[model samples]
Target chain A: MKIAIDAMGGDHAPEEIVKGVEMARDRYPELEFMLFGTESEVKPLIQSMDRLELIPTTEVIAMGDEPVKAMKEKQDSSLVQAANAVKEGKADALFSAGNTGALLSSAIFIVGRIRGVERPALATAFPAFGGPHREFVFMDLGANAENKPSHLYQYGILGTFYAESVMGISNPRVRLLNNGGEEDKGDDVHKAAHQLMKNTDAFNFLGNVEAREIMEGTADVVVADGFSGNATLKAIEGTALTMMGQIKEAIKGSGIRGILGALMLKPALKAMKHKMDFQENGGAVVLGVKAPVVKTHGSAKANAVANSMGQIQTMVEGKLVDKTAEFIKENADKLKVKKAAK
Target chain B: MKIAIDAMGGDHAPEEIVKGVEMARDRYPELEFMLFGTESEVKPLIQSMDRLELIPTTEVIAMGDEPVKAMKEKQDSSLVQAANAVKEGKADALFSAGNTGALLSSAIFIVGRIRGVERPALATAFPAFGGPHREFVFMDLGANAENKPSHLYQYGILGTFYAESVMGISNPRVRLLNNGGEEDKGDDVHKAAHQLMKNTDAFNFLGNVEAREIMEGTADVVVADGFSGNATLKAIEGTALTMMGQIKEAIKGSGIRGILGALMLKPALKAMKHKMDFQENGGAVVLGVKAPVVKTHGSAKANAVANSMGQIQTMVEGKLVDKTAEFIKENADKLKVKKAAK
Candidate 1:
């Protein structure tokens, strides 16, 4: 199977994307890559290879450009072109480290979404505690804001499918993220979703889980509206960064004694930092689409880019799309009630 | 000044609380502490100190009991008796490392609110990079759920007062805690609060601050509704703990190479861990009240209890209650707008 890579995306684009493609090609010699960008920009980065194919495109989308507007006006842009490659079946999947909104909009508008899906969601895997720990999937991380209760229920269904497909966890435990772990502690939307999840047999409803429980290995699939999920994710990221910076200053501030103590604790500290790193999870996948689309971090390095490519391969080879299709078809009536209510 | 201590509160109550009182008496020679609990529980622990007063009580609030129910029925409970001391003018203030919800209710319903106060908020100092570095004061940590726009504005005002009064910062900058740094990223409540803050002459309204900015020393006061603030705070704590655990495992997972790298990075890691520890922030202060009420952590040790007592002294000596009263009186018209809207 071939996957299209947005060569003009990311800070270290063209080079890192090319390196990632080469790494993937080395591992799976039968795998083909369709690199999209201007020949002049792509030539210096692409080493001579038979399987690596460069699809020439003159336009490129700047990182700061507005997504919806750029997608509408810049038809010839590399992001749009790469997406078109997936649409035309030239590649089975599309990967970009460009503007997240633009990549999502391009995938939905250009390649299109599944028939019954109302809105596509951006899904990410969170590492749980313990060995061979199963990852929990959450939808609409930042894709759709101001979600209705039905949207949240749909997210639960989609997230369950994604978890079962990728993590290979059968009958995954599904939970609604709330302020308090109690069922009655959330706002109106959360209360509505709580009832829906309880009534539906589409998922393994585990009841309300607090933000703290997310990291404590409470559920296999956590669901929420984009605003809360995105806010929670950003808050976690911010706190991790803030704590790291504080730890650095504090150890140094202790002068000699503090520095000595810090010296003794160094090994455990590095291990801690790596666990908090976002790169370890690869990147977020845009779910509910006709084909796989992975949106890596905009500032992703070579290793991050390589991991994202591997994620694409995992999704494609794991038949995640087919599993999602099957799940949707089997649970069509519940989804119908959900859609009607919306 | 005399302060009532709930000797029956917290995980290590009676024992730790007694030790903390002894430490406080030794530290502040002129200060007096009234230990509220059954005489049987307090007699064996501390019966010699001249400054240590014992106020006997019989009931106890279990850890799992609902706050309102506990407050209403456990009339002679240690937590209630402590609050009664504050209400009857026997003690200058009350301190408890107990059920936070129960403490909050007793303070509001029993001790009563300050005149003209619409709602009382819980404010906690989050240690920044280093050297105090302008600790962030967040309000309504868990007092009220489903907060309105006006409630957020009031939080900004009260939070600013706490920062300036307790932390000794002049004209503390106040920011709304939002999902993103952008002005337009929050929910309807945030948008409304944003407009109110800009127009009202009550604070030095800095715009919307993302979750990461809380630890980056961007604002002295980060205000939000209780639900979001509580969730965000807990999520941060959970992530830090998880990261610390993972880091330790990673260092031990591999062989000598990992051990050598871990050894080399010991000091740096220790420094990082120390910074994320929130216990250094003392306890969360209940702002916009008639008296200085400090809520210690449920798991607070002797040092944390001491920190809470120290905070009370700082506020009382500075006469922050009078200063905050003046500030509120001066901005009475603006505050009335909030009261009317709510």
Candidate 2:
């Protein structure tokens, strides 16, 4: 399997990107990487070229450029070129730690969407409490700020497929993220989406899941409109960070005894930190597209980038994108019939 | 001043409610309490009748009862009666730990909305990072699930007054909560609200606040449509609870060394826990109402209830509601002119 990497992106950029490729190539001998970037900038960063191929590109898309405009204008940029490689069937998947919007735009416009899909969603795994599974898939994490009930329903279907095929969950329990767990909860959009999800047998519908229940591992797939999803995601991230910071301050302010306690509690704290680290989840995936496209955080270093590569390899090997396309194709006629009835 | 208390509400009910009233009465010698509940259930719990008066009522609103219906049908209930006391000017303020929706309904219907206020909002203080002022107020927590741009603007006004008078922040930095801090970010509704806030001189309108910046002590009041506000609030609460649970598990699984470290770190943990506790912030206030009506957590104990009473006392003494009404009266013509222009 081959993966296309956007080398001139993220905080560390080509250096960490190349190191990550080398690490993945060493671990998975059958996998190959195509690095896209300016030759002079990326050449010195590559330690070994055993299973790696450099696809030189002249332009670079800056982090702050508008997504759609940048994707259209920077045709020769690394992000665009990397996405194009997947579009031309040169690679099975595409990976980037670039501007999220730009990567998503390239995925949708360049690589294209599944035939029956109206909009593509970005899915990230949120760490869950005590269960056989460590996390659950939460989708539409800011791909579209506004979504119709139909779009939300489609997210449920896409999220279910991604959870089952990529995350290896069987008959993945899918749920609509609502204000309350009751059937009559949420606004008109969520209410309509809930009913639609309930009538479908495509996945195990678990009804409404509230924000408080999200981290409790109540469902394998939690679907929401991008606005609420993005807000909830950021809230969790912010709270966790603030609490951790406060805890550190508290410990430090506790005098000499606190220092000794910290030393003894280092192992436990380390374990907790690892559990809270989102990088361990291997980043978010832009689902409903024709090919697998993964995006790591812009600040992601070698370990996170390598983990993202491994995640992409798994998606490719499991044929998750192909499965999604087949599922959408099978449902096309049913969806059309439903729409006609409506 | 007299404060009306719903003595038969919350998980602990009459016992904790009466206990909290006694605590408050002792702390504030000049203040009186009007306990609304069945005399049989509440009289036995009161420590002294010095400044306490039990107002007997037979009906009780359960936690699961629908809000508006319960408010209308259960007029004799403790929650309703407590709110009615404020409405009739028999009490300066009202406090309850009952069903939040029912309390809000009663506050709006019985106590009434301030003139020119479109909707009443639930505002709660979220713990902020290291500052002399420990928390910031987040409004429209779940009062109105859907809000117009006008309602959001009104929240900014209400939140500002509450922050200044009750929270003791001078010219508090108020912000509109959006997905991003960019000027043109968020959906159409938020964008319009941003423009409205930007044009207003009623409050200290900071451009925009993202969820990640909420806990960083960046703003004194963060305004959001109820949907996003509630989601963000619950996400923060859920993350804190989940992280605390995980940390406990981590310590337990680490053996004797971890156990000793935990013992040594007890004080630090206690301090951190206190900082994260929502009860420390004195519960949520029902803003835009004629009277100051505060809703404590449904499972609140004596400490939380007493803290809520203290909060209500502060509001009444500071005349926050009256100040809000005055602000609305002063701006009534300006708003009318703006609406006419629209």
Candidate 3:
């Protein structure tokens, strides 16, 4: 199995990307990588030549560049070339730690969407609180600004398949993210989506789950329209950040005794932080694409990049994308958007 | 100023309600309260009825009961009677620590909507991370499931007036709660709302703010469609609860030294918790109503109940509801929904 890497992407760029690629190459016996970046920048960073093929590219997509515009203008950029490698079937999957918009663009427009899939969703795994499954997948993390009931239903199936095949959860329970946790509690779109999901025999349909109940691991997969999903996700992240920051301030403001107390409790706090760390789940998968495309964090180190590569390898080896494509293709009628009637 | 109090509501009803009413009556020299509840159950709890009047009500609206149905059927309920007092001009404002949905029903159908107001929004003040203003008001916290650009525009005006009149924030910044921070970042509804707010010479429109920036106090007033508002609010609350729970577990699971350290940090942690508590900001206001109607937490104690009454007193003394009604009525044309034309 082969994966195309956008070597010029991320904060660490060539050095960390090359090191991570080498780590994954040594780890996976049958895996190979085609690194796309400036030759001089990426060449010396590589520790081993074994199973690593460097494909030089002239242009680079900066973090601030407009996604669609950059993709069109920067034809020789590493992100573009890496996406092309997957499109041409030279590689089984694509991986990047670049700009999220650019990576998503590469996944959708370049690598292409699977036949019958309306829109690609960003699927990220998150830590769940005290359940059999310590983690759950949240889909459509701001991929599409607006979505029809059909797209939401499709996300239900896509997320379910991802959990079963990639995360190894059998018959994953799928829940629609709603404002209130009830059968008929939501806006027109969510209420319609709930009905659509309930009627289908595609996956294990759990009823609506509220944002508050998400961390409790009530559902293995939480599906939402991109706008609400993005807003809610940020709320959780922002709240957590604010609370932690305040705690730090409190500890500092409490003077010597409090500082000494915090010092002794470092291990416990570290453990909590480790559990909350989303990076341990690897990068987010731009699902519904023809091939597996994962986007790691921009500030990812060698270990994080290697872990993302491992996730990509699992997706490719399990043929998760192929399974999703075939399923969607077969159920195109059910997944078709019909909101105009509403 | 006279405020109608719903005595037979919340977890600690009658007892806490009466105590709080007495506290507020004592604190505010000219304040009088009409306590609505079953007289037999309420009168014994009142230590001194100097300015507090106990009005007998036969029925009660349980939290589990349907809001609209309860409002329609339970006419003699405390929540209904208190709201009726406000509507009949027997009381200057209304206060309830009851079922949010039921209180909202009373506020709308009984107290009535402010003229030209499209919808009544739930405005709750949350503790900001750190700023000149430690608290910021978030509006439309699940009052209307869906909202047009016009409703969103009105939320800006309503929320701004609220901050100025009640919270005492001079030239309060009003921001549209969106998924993205950019001016052109949201979906159709939000994009149009941004345009509407930007074009109008009504309030201080500070463009769009993502859910994450909310706690940072980027704006004094953050307005959103009810669905997004509810979801985001719950996410923030849920994440905080989860993190605190995890920290408690960590402290408990830690060895003797860690536990000792945590014990020493109690004062500091308490300060942090105090800062994070939303109850200090009083109850949520059902804005765009004829009178200042507020709903405190269901689990509110005497202190919290008194605090909310203080908020209501401020709103009443400032003629906030009347000011809001006049402003919205004057700007009816600008706030009219024309999305069908779009």
TM-score of each: 0.89, 0.98, 0.95
Please list the C-alpha lDDT of all candidates, in the order they appear: 0.79, 0.87, 0.88
The model with the greatest lDDT is: 3
Query: What is the per-residue lDDT of model 3 for residues B34-116, given as tens digits with 9 covering 90 to 100?
Result: 99999899988989879888899999999778899999999999999989998989999989998899999999999999887
Instruction: Report the lDDT tens digits of candidate 1 across residue range A238-257.
Output: 87777667667766776776
Predicted complex 1: DockQ: 0.37
Report the TM-score of candidate 1, chain B only.
0.94
lDDT of 2 by residue, A224-342 (tens): 88988999999998988887887788789998888778778889988888888876659899999999899989888888888888888888888888888888888887566545433
Q: Which CAPRI quality tier does the interface of model 2 achieve?
A: high
Give the CAPRI class of candidate 1: acceptable
Determine the TM-score of chain B of model 2: 0.97
Candidate 2 segments whose C-alpha is farther than 4 A from its true place: A337-342, B130-132, B337-342
Each model's chain A TM-score = 0.94, 0.97, 0.95
Q: Model 1 Cα displacement at A281 (Å)?
A: 4.6
**Residue B243 in model 1: lDDT:** 72
Give the range of the ten consecutive residues with the poorest summed lDDT in model 2 chain A: A333-342
Question: Can you tell me which runs of candidate 1 are displaced by over 4 Å?
Answer: A52-59, A87-90, A131-134, A138-140, A242-272, A278-281, A336-342, B115-117, B130-134, B250-272, B336-342
